[model samples]
Target: MADKKIWQELCSMVHPGHVFQDEPLGKYTFTKTGGKADFLVFPESFEEVQKTVQYAVANDIPYTILGNGSNLIIKDGGIRGIVLILTKLTKISLQGSEITAQSGAAIIDVSRYALKAKLTGLEFACGIPGSVGGALYMNAGAYGGEIKDVLSRAVVLTKTGQLKHLEKEDLYFHYRKSSIAENGEIVLEGVFSLEPGDVQKIKARMDELTFLRESKQPLEYPSCGSVFKRPPGYFAGKLIQDSGLQGTQIGGVQVSTKHAGFMVNVGGGTATDYMNLIKHVQKTVKQKFGVDLETEVKIIGEDLKKQES
Candidate 1:
């Protein structure tokens, strides 16, 4: 637990309305399951983010940057220290063939904005459910397109609260990972370079991809998207399906029947339930196919019961 004095100091750094203590994380994450955070702050501006981060570092407090809470699993024990949410920092603008988006702007909204502007390169991201920062952090991709392909440059806030612009080459994006994630830099905004295209054609492509996602994925249930990364020369979903693990249930979580790659929360699922189900799938897939499944979703936070012990 954080020192009471430090908490008070943090509360003083931001508006009372923007700072929350012991906030339930389940209410914010996509899976709708997790523990409470000691502090959750929604910063409306980049400067506010910088101030909060600087204070945390100076005071020797732990902190985590959250973006839309997609593709994440927080343990039932919740998170320690401060959790900074950038959701309120959403802003997007288009200039010529370049699109600039604040870190908190939803990727889907950005894709739609591109479509409205008759931009072509962002069609593949129309169905991605993460924010710009999250997408950049993980090099998020779909339908054979990834963020690295369109992003020209990004403004990042370093651990020491220094702002730096990293070009696409500096980002070093690869298979759902990026340098920003490795360096723990906070993405402030990004500029995407796209080409002119017919608006109707762009919309048609987005609609098609959206339909494909809804058709193949379990849209009805809560999940952290794909549970595992695809192994070399093999598809994770195909392997799980072939292993007959589809629809397998443990507690309230189950292997998605619609798509074997996803483990869904049917109802009242806990993070432990999700973790157990993940292990089961991994073991089953390995035994049947001799391929180890690596997780794509990020799992964090302490286990509450274990911490109490």
Candidate 2:
């Protein structure tokens, strides 16, 4: 088949072992849902990523870059073309109150590294469950700090496979959104500038935030983190709770009783189930409060029905 030939060529670009065909995407996502990727490639280095992108562009094959998959939902029909997961690019280093992390480096690990270096600003990120790239793409934040507050610069690969360096000003960060998402840029690495602080104080702050996150979030089950963005003056969780949508279940997914904002996979949930539940919540909350709930989570891929068609 034509698809087989293209993926075989992809294997030549990345190592054959790292290239997978019809790879189930659920195994890599936080939600433990989704169907498959036609071709999944894990590139270990920046150059590998470049080659993959160039190839995809030249061949006119659609490609997507994924980091950690902490705040995403891929639909049930899986994705077509190449799906590049940057998990193998995990690398972190520090120099002169700055931390440089590869896109695949967990934002949580980067925060810990900052702590070890006696850095202060990233303490708020001590519990964010996302990759550095994902954090930058969405301007990820928790407690009182956000990626945009500390991000000095980022190296991104443009959709055309050109490498570009973007400063903080170039990113144009806003509440839970960034220029990266708008331009469809793939983050290769991020440099964060932090202030030097007392080690004991930094550790204490991280510990406090960690405790708050664990106590407030449903960490025991697989769930997409933070289903909806804050709607203007009101909190998404509070709106959902007031709507009395907690403990609502569709298929195997349930709105967490512990956290009104998170929808957890109690057992074998599907992307269809998640999507239907999200719509239900949005509709219910809108009907009750007259506030439109917007999702913070990114959903992609295709539907099984669409694929069959």
Candidate 3:
């Protein structure tokens, strides 16, 4: 049910066009499987964000901030409250040796910006799909480098709505995880110090990573990137492949034969299909090698649909 008061408040506080109802979140997500969000608010400025946040808080309504939806899976039942997509908040600029990017700006765009500036360190992220905010929140990495290697600081909004700057050390970034995710902190922007190098050289390195990723990954299918974290002493994909789980299907989702790390929706797949396939793979792998695998993708909301069935 729509809260009349909240509607009036949103209309008063935000641009009328920016507030959307029953927004189809699937289109926004890389997986293309989620249901509609109750409300999707796209704020153009920090003030709009603050207003939306204050309203949700004061009214005791739940809210979750979402980035570009690159590495996320929203459930079939979908999220109940408001989802604030920071994608519209994209802003990028350079100052001297430092570059600042708004949370919603694509990390790849930031990398490209740095490359144009002849800044070399962010090249590892040139092929990453998530926004800068999500990248920093998750300490996203590819190949050997990670956000911690170049990130100097970030501005974040606390769960309580207070803004503060956190240093790289304060962010507590580790492989595929960070303090922001652990503490439920909302990233607003980030500043990274990149050393200048030959733009041509930077482009060449980025091109190589891009080529390698595309050569192996199933870019055609909608997926939540790598399905599992690298298990110790072995690559997750290799283990799954060794277990002979390739092209395995539960409902419409299948383990990619090309790259066992991905669980792809072969077409007409739902979240239940994807999850069931994940469980099946886990069971088979554990049964085969006595090695328990861990998922890297974050699964939110209830998994009841799979359970009830």
Candidate 4:
């Protein structure tokens, strides 16, 4: 557990009703299998986020930035120190052909806003179930389009709590990885430059992508979108499928029969179940295909038994 005095100090920095103690993390994550957080703070504004982070740094309390929790797996022993959630910092604005959105804004909603504004470039992100910060954090892409294709610049909060504006080149985006991941900077907002396009055409593209996603993905169950990064010349799903690992279950978690890339929580899965299954798939795929698979999902927090031991 975090220090009570530090928790009190953090609570004073944010608005009333924003701080929670011993909060269950499963309620916030997509997999619904995490333990708890020592302290969870949902900041409503950028200033609140800055204040919280600054205080945590000055006080020497460990801190973490949590976006929509779509591509993360928290362990059963839970996270220590402060966990900041940016869901309430959702503010978006449109300036002519460009859209500026806060990090907490959902990428899907941003794509919809762009579509309504007749913007052409964000059509591929209409089905991505992550926030703007998370999308930018990993250079998220789909259907041949990526954040690197449209993002002009972003405002970031460094680990030292200083703000900086980073251009597209500074982002260093590539294949589900970004400089932000390496630098540990917190994305505050992004300005996406788009082009004027036919509204009907943009809508058509979004609809097509949405249909394709729904048809193929196991959206019915609880799981992170994709568990592994795409290998250089092979698709993660095809590799797992060809290995005959589809529908394989470890405890309550199963490799999706619909898409082998996904590990789904059927009913009562735990993080251990998911991790064990991921290792099993990696070992099997490496043995059969000689290609190593890397995880795209962010896994954090300690293990329950580790604390007990």
Best by TM-score: 2
Q: List pairs with backbone clashes in candidate 2.
A: none
lDDT for position 239 in model 2: 94
- Order the candidates by lDDT, highest first: 2, 4, 1, 3
lDDT of 2 by residue, 196-268 (tens): 9999999999999999999999999999999999999999999999999999999999999999999999999
* lDDT (Cα) of model 4: 0.93
Q: After superposition, how far is residue 234 of candidate 4 from its true place, in Å?
A: 0.7
**Per-residue lDDT over 1-309 for candidate 3, one digit per residue giving the tens place of the 0 to 100 score:** 356666667878888788777787778888887776777888898888877887888777788899998887777767767788988889999999899999999999999999889888999998888999999988898898899999999999887677788988898887888999999888899999999899889999999999999999998888888889888898989999999999998887889978999988788888767777888999999999988888877776445455337
TM per candidate comes to 0.97, 0.99, 0.95, 0.98
Q: How well does candidate 1 score on lDDT at residue 225?
A: 92
Task: Look at candidate 4 and tell me the lDDT of residue 273.
Answer: 93
Which parts of model 4 have CA positions greater than 4 angstroms off? none
Q: Candidate 1: deviation at residue 98, Å?
A: 0.7
Local error of candidate 1 at residue 270 (angstroms): 0.4
CA lDDT of 306 in candidate 3? Answer: 56
TM-score of 3: 0.95
In terms of lDDT, which candidate is stronger, 3 or 4?
4
Root-mean-square deviation of every model: 1.2, 0.8, 2.0, 1.1
